[model samples]
Target: MSEEKAVEENPVTDAEATPVPEAPRPPLARRLLRSRTVRAATAAALAGALLGAGTVAWRTDTLPLAGSSAPCWDSLGSGSMDALFGDRRTEVDEQSLHDDPMGGTGAYGQCRITSYEGDRARRQVTVNVRRLDGLRGTDAQDWPREFLSSGMVSLGDGLPGMASSSRAWIALPQACTGRDDFTGPTVVDIGMGRADFEVSPDEAPRDRTALTGALIDAANGVIDGFGCSGTYREPRDLHPPVLWDSTRTSMFCGIKGLALPAAYRKELRETRASGEGGPAQVCEAGYDSDETAVRLTTVTDPALSEIYSSDALHSGAPVKGTRGYGKIGGNRAVFKALCQTGPVMFVLEQLRPAGKGSRFTFTRDLLPAYVAAEAERIGCGPQKLTLPAP
Candidate 1:
């Protein structure tokens, strides 16, 4: 049986045992092309690439996404950015003038001029003018306006032009009655440089003229008002003389003189001589403890010191050292000082900041010469003239 095993069926043929030979692998490109899924995928990919390229070309050709406008692009011209942002600015022209609501009677004018002594770096003087009209009340309100306007406008336009320009603003109201009892005049004001002036119907022409002349004179020279003079003193002085007129303008000056307290007056009188600088009563008002007295112990004598401390406790003893405290709005302290000086009153205010001391010094030093020059131009007598309502 063993030998016969050789007769057992011949070993299986290699062909029958082994599997059939496989075809060679296809190239990557060929494989892609052959399969429907792969081919479709490739076609889709190509279409996407073409679309991207078209988009880029269109953007570059039409307008760049960055820096889309010119360097000088303005919404005002194109109305593009303006439309987006909303227009907020309005145009204004100098040719247009608004009509005054009060029957077109109100008008304004201004003038300014600068006097240069050297090159552009050096300026010797500046004058300004301002004028306003159509007011209906007290001269007090109008006087200040006229003064300031004439001064300010002179700085821009010459003094001659300022006077001429003011004429247009001088139309008076039709029959302004004193009985109207109105608050004050309505004024339209203009400014040139530093000076401003306004005039109501109430202001007298003579007063206006005087003020104008004074302002012009001041531009050329020196002038003082409201306790401020064209004069100045050395900066080192602790207390310099003030420019004040007790005889001319008495309202503020009188009030100032009477404000001293009694205690201060007693101290000043006792310490200083009677005539040296004692307070003197200038007005008709009677001085009695009942009317103006603060307390029995503390009094403002109104004779020695326009304002003084009556109580020895509150008198000279420093409140917080150099700084003293007094009743607010009361002139007891002032009166005490004035009583010591008598009828005359003085106010010493700095005309300029300490750093600009030179300007003040120059003004004072040249004041006499300036005043003389001003007298020739405007006449030296009183410029103000009072006239009854027409």
Candidate 2:
């Protein structure tokens, strides 16, 4: 065992230690021309760089985002020139379809017309008609399928409360469109929530007379469809509380009607004649200023009041002025100023419940921006963001 004592090996000295090899890097030009697995990669990258440079040059040579001018009436419906401009009903030629930066294609037998004015030449009026085809593809498709599938819900019924829910697209003028330049058609888009429907067309002595008559007829149609009874309330007056439920249940909903402003009166008349359920109530005249407007309409049920109030408070122009909640009819409210500048119409609808500690939540957080946009349409000032209410 002693004789078999092992021979041990020693570790290498520091001087004998092997060094690690360094990674190789190519020259700048070589790096730029380096090729990946694909042979055309270098060529593709070069092409992309040139394209990007061209785009930048083109944008710099063009108009600024704040002041650009484009055509307004490049598109018109096909038919006898008379059909497009005549009082008679006729089919719209599909080939004649054109893009309207301010307005989209009309649905439900609807047609749209837009006009503009000002140094910026902003769109001032937009007339819309309901067309069957338009109805099929418009925002109506984006609505809750449940509501559409159920048709009209009766206020008498306990669950979905409202007797019916219908949608009407409000043609917004190009001034209302969010484009930096007012070069599009004169019209903005709006949705009429849960409107009443009717099928009467009253006769009038003249075209203008007929248009006004049709507007009234349409208003009545909506009112009748909602089954509103008991006396009519003036635009500035409040209705009886008995007509609404104090509970958190569903109720019938509609626009907050307002008197049309003189500035837009003529356009409103023409819009009504086109048959798309006149302009949005909030967009009417008296409501067009920086001030706030309030009114009450009968809801099919009480729950609907919550929904409607929520929508109103959260909808329309964002509240301006103070940061804290304001009181109106014993309800907590927030204020927001809509359109600032341009020919666009603006409105602010306050929402708060009848009791203590009431608050309305907005559907989208960008509502303030939406309001500012509206203000810009009418050439108003910028919005002042405020701290949240306590």
Best by lDDT: 2
| Tens-digit lDDT string for candidate 1 (96-188) | 011222333221111222222333422111122111221321232233333222111221111112221232121111121011121222221
Candidate 2: tens digits of C-alpha lDDT, residues 1-390: 011111112111223321111134233123212211111223444555532232110111111123321111111212212221244222221111122322442211122232223223221112232211111223212321222212222222011111121222211111111122212221211112223222222311122222222222222222221222211111111111111111111111112112323332222221110111112112111122212122212221111112223333443343443221211222223332332212222223323221123223321222344334433333344543442443
> Model 1 residue 303 lDDT?
18
State the displacement of the C-alpha of residue 104, model 1, in Å, after optimal TM-score superposition.
6.2
lDDT, residue 57, model 2: 9
lDDT of 2: 0.22
**Candidate 2, residue 62: lDDT:** 17
Which 10 consecutive positions of candidate 2 have the poorest summed lDDT?
55-64
lDDT of model 1 at position 271: 12
What is the lDDT, from 0 to 100, of the residue 151 in candidate 1? 18
How many clashing residue pairs appear in each of the predictions shown? 78, 51
User: lDDT for every model?
Assistant: 0.21, 0.22
Local lDDT at 85 for model 2: 27
